[model samples]
Target: MIKEVGIIGLGNVGKVLATFLKANGMLYWAVSRSAADDENILRNISDIKELPSLIIIAVADKYISAVSEKLAHKFGKELEGVFVFHLSGALSRNELILCENNGAIIASAHPFQTFFVTGNYENVFVDVLEGISWGIDCKAEYFPEIEKFINKLLGKAKYLSSETLAKKAIYHASAVAVSNYLTAAITLAKKMANLADIEAEDFLLPIIKTTIKNNFSDVDFPITGPIARCDLAVVKEHLENLSVKPHLQKSYAFFGAALLELIKDEKIMSEEQIKQLEAILLQKHLY
Candidate 1:
């Protein structure tokens, strides 16, 4: 039932949010500090005449507090009864305490998806919001309204307790580990593939896709590699081969150690084998 929204940033996430809201026939006023050619975007927060029912401070984490304070200074107590939130996964509703103090219903809602403004706005599908999970940390009293708003976007609302900082931090850390770290791993893989004169995409794409599919479909033990099989010899050979690129070798070792920690409890390998593999991965020369 939320009809109007105010977005205070125009970066990748902000642009996608604006596009999605506009596509869904919701009235939105987007504000950006930087000069933009778009007629719909306002260049200053002071230019906003009327505050929307829902205001999303989509700025970077470093600016969330400052922007919240700015809104409080600009609109004052007019923010009362308004739903104000940010798109930060790591930060809790505390970042908007200024607005909250002014009686705004504050929350932090992070969509569990990577966003990139690649091309035309028309090509930016609003359907990307469909079926994705949103990490929402807010007061219990405000949760139902937020849940309804997410439901409207066809996203599941995962309530993260605002009382616990560790939970929110861990939630965001897990997101970074999966999304950002996965990208880094793939980049490394592509680089290694290119070094061997193979078309990186042609060789890595299909397997990467399959591995991800298997990872989701087979949750019990989706890992498959020399590490999974406890093939220390193969791992050692890989390290030896990667020695020419010490940076890549260090990355591989770090990832291998982390992976070993992940599967250690699965009992895929004996303790002695695990120790040996750990020793190989932790060898000072790799660092």
Candidate 2:
């Protein structure tokens, strides 16, 4: 029974997670070394010695190693038998192996979802975690509580073992791709739109919204614009016009190549079409 859910960092992620946990009638405790006193009640406590059953550290990666080092001292102390966890996507469960050595069960319960302070984000976890992946690497005891917390709150948990680290890395990278790279791609597209003399960013709202809806709903089949239509003429013009953004030409070419490959794999484009797109891309010589 996770009566008290303790957080070590009180950023947007920590705050939102604590909110969800507390809303479920669980005790919320947190500690932040650099936080202001007026930030949140659960924050401001800098030491984690007293420790709760499930202690979540949402700090920077550099500090996580140090944090685990500090927790390592508590081995055979009061903090023994605690369930230690974090929210980092790239780091492994071994970074906190010291905590495990100290008799603290260690795992990572990263929500495969984005964090936003406002907007309709509470429901973002609604269907997102139906078959969504989570992570953990500890003895058998901690999993049932973690799964219970995940299932009862808003999502599901997929346990991770040492053998599944590669899949977990890929999964976390995919989440980053969806959030980080999607934003980058959209920013690039917005620059392209700006080239079309579409100045106001608000003008992109409906397009952005529809594109995201398509992404969440369509998956691999979500293709639009000239590439999906096999309009090489438009692609040629795009390559020609991309001279204004010399650094972006290679990226555009890469995306076009990937897009073509996807289309061909779907049987939407013929071999000749692929050749034409490839030749035009080669002519640009964005390499």
- Best candidate according to TM-score: 1
Error of 2 at 246 (Å): 3.9
Worst 10 residues of 2 by lDDT: 39-48
lDDT of 2 by residue, 164-202 (tens): 776767867888888887777777778777878886377
Query: Residue 122 of model 2: what lDDT?
Result: 55
Best prediction by lDDT: 1
Structural similarity to truth (TM-score) of each candidate = 0.90, 0.77
lDDT of each: 0.86, 0.72
Positional deviation of 163 in candidate 2, in angstroms?
Answer: 5.5
Error of 1 at 87 (Å): 1.2
Cα lDDT of model 1 by residue, 152-263, tens digit = 7678998875454567778788889888999989998997897778999999999999988988894877888888888889999998899888999999899999888877
- Which runs of model 2 end up more than 4 angstroms from their true locations? 22-28, 39-46, 116-133, 161-163, 199-220, 247-251, 261-268, 282-287
Superposition error at 54 for model 1 (Å) = 1.0
